[model samples]
Target: MVDAHETFVIIGGGLAGAKAAETLRAEGFTGRVIIIGDERDHPYERPPLSKGYLAGSKERDSVFVHPPAWYAQAEIELHLGEPAVDINRETRSVTLGDGTTIQYDALLLATGAEPRRLDVPGTRLAGVHHLRRLAHADQLRGMLTRLGRENGQLVVAGAGWIGLEVAAAARHYGAEVTVIEPNPSPLHGVLGPEMGGLFTQLHAEHGVRFHFGSGITEILGQDGQVLAVRTDDGEEHPAHGVLVAIGAAPRTALAASAGLEIDPATGGVSVDAALRTADPAIFAAGDAAAFWHPTLGTRLRVEHWANALNGGPAAARSMLGQEVSYDRLPYFFSDQYELGMEYSGWAPPGSYDQVVCRGDVGKPEFIAFWLKEGRVLAGMNVNVWDVTDRIQQLIRNGTTVDAERLADPTTPLPE
Candidate 1:
């Protein structure tokens, strides 16, 4: 293991970066650790950006991983608001945006992603927004305070998790919300058509109108402010503003610049089972890194919060010379309106032979378990936390389960 006196430089100050630093300290590493991030604020939690926080149910300071004083107390040098521009592998150093070079014996890249913008006319208008950072949330919060409910309509350009959550938050603030999805259902691409239909109905019940199976042609605006959005179906919907949350692409410019292997498919930095990139001295985690899963025999790039928190510590262990590989079950959750949805594991694309759904999707409580060749591959839970957590444990332990028992909600998961 590298000595505590050795220097470690981490790029990005998001969840993964913060966790790595904390883990390193907990592991008794008193090394010179420096964290660099373009965002000025201390590392903060982001899951609330779409839920209670966006709904104004939680304070902004409550999401911080550590207050400004904690980083100073912990002696973790935080280079806030500074972006790393280049990496010199030969010299074992990284260059910041301000042309300062920091030498490091080990490096970690946890640079997260940015929101994907809608490419169309009037996208540059004053009222067009994309939710990805604290600044974006603050801007939208300001608009919410200005509008105050009636006659305040917001157009969401996608029906993905972020888009849907933002719409739900806007609705909570008494703003009329409309979602336009290019697919047949809001979450069709992520959860398949059958399950996506469940969410579509849920949103409709919450007074959020959906215009699916259509594409946006342009964002219409007046006096540099958003007024309406037009779709390819020749339908025009009035809007006070627009939010584009189609998805995200990895922030892998630093890795690519350092000549690390970039996955062509995911456009993210490719790492091994040990979370180490091509350079032995450097490691990566979170949304920006793609790793191969042993069970599926396929590469997976997770953008979920759980993956980052779990993978961050695992990466730090490997960086500390522990022979550990990050192989935890991938899980994600979303709060839409009044519904809670949680999903775990991965179902190979088009591999699930049957889907067993329990409870009534109409009653706002149900769970769907995906099975392939009689093995539980993945499960989606809506307002069902016990079964979700139980099934997650079963899957992690590789327990054999009866299909009938899984399908029937009457039988509890076996101990």
Candidate 2:
């Protein structure tokens, strides 16, 4: 049990860390709270980096999790640009990058994840970039704006959410864009082929070209600047800039170095239902935590915004010796061009037996549900507004539904 005067330290000043700090104060903890971050900027929302921020529709201050004054007002020490390098479990202390050591009664690791980089040659070129931080997005936005003026091509590697969103923003800036994905279709692994095909058609309508079933063998460049990309098939595509959005790897080195249990499958800190790590004094949240999900009956790590937002408070409550379960339905949303979408619940690959669609796919607006044994496991609504609550309720209820009624738009979801 932690004393009222003991210090609580949090690593990684992203949304999860910020939210955790907020929860601690809100819960009336009088102990000192400190947030350490590697980046110079304060905690900020990352979702806008690929959407409004990249498109220049949102200002720099709009992305911050809280204004600069909030941390000081809350009496939370902000350790900006200083990363936690080592964790000493025996001493219950953490060593910062600057070699300062701080003792903690309780610690939260919300280290988050970093973007995976393409290992191809010329990745070091001036025109090549990856989107994981505000600085990266700022650089890409500048490049896209210049490319728009020059009518240059923007070659994006990977057709995942980040890649597609970047492509949409670049297209909106009037830059010619091409997305390269090794998968057969965009988001095929998550949404399945049918819904993935809809995204393909949507991008095609906006004049975005796709190179499917192909991997980038090399990034061609001249004079330290990217010029084009060479695919495995020996085809060269023009490129004034390149955005690599393959995926993200969890930031688990600190947890692993501390001899904490790490999930080898997901490269995340292994945690129980309460988000407590193997060490009683330590806990993890957000992207770095592979937590046991009671509903799914398995361990899973989510990188979505909602998970961090909700998980922070849950982790804090648990740390305060309150009974808590961080098992809310995993939810996420994305916006590209004119289309907006929200997905809820867990539908692991190959776990669902069938998919039922409500509304017309041709209209490019509908809700698709993944089911097993006629029970809804997960659902996604694309370009359809105000139905996410119903979709989540359907999954939560886990009631068997008639396929005919599920497919019929006129039939109410609860019916």
The number of the candidate with the highest TM-score is 2
lDDT of 2 by residue, 149-208 (tens): 999999999998999999999999999999999999998778877578989998999999
| C-alpha positional error of residue 374 in candidate 1 after TM-score superposition, expressed in Å | 1.8
> Model 2 residue 297 lDDT?
84
Consecutive 10-residue window with the lowest summed lDDT within model 2 = 1-10
Please state the error at residue 117 of candidate 1 in Å: 1.6
Looking at candidate 1, the ten consecutive residues that score lowest on lDDT are 142-151
Q: Which stretches of model 2 miss by more than 4 angstroms?
A: 1-4
lDDT of 1 by residue, 129-235 (tens): 88778878888876765555555888898899998898888877778889999898877767777788887877788788999988789999888999899999999
Collision pairs in model 1: none
lDDT winner: 2
lDDT of each: 0.84, 0.92
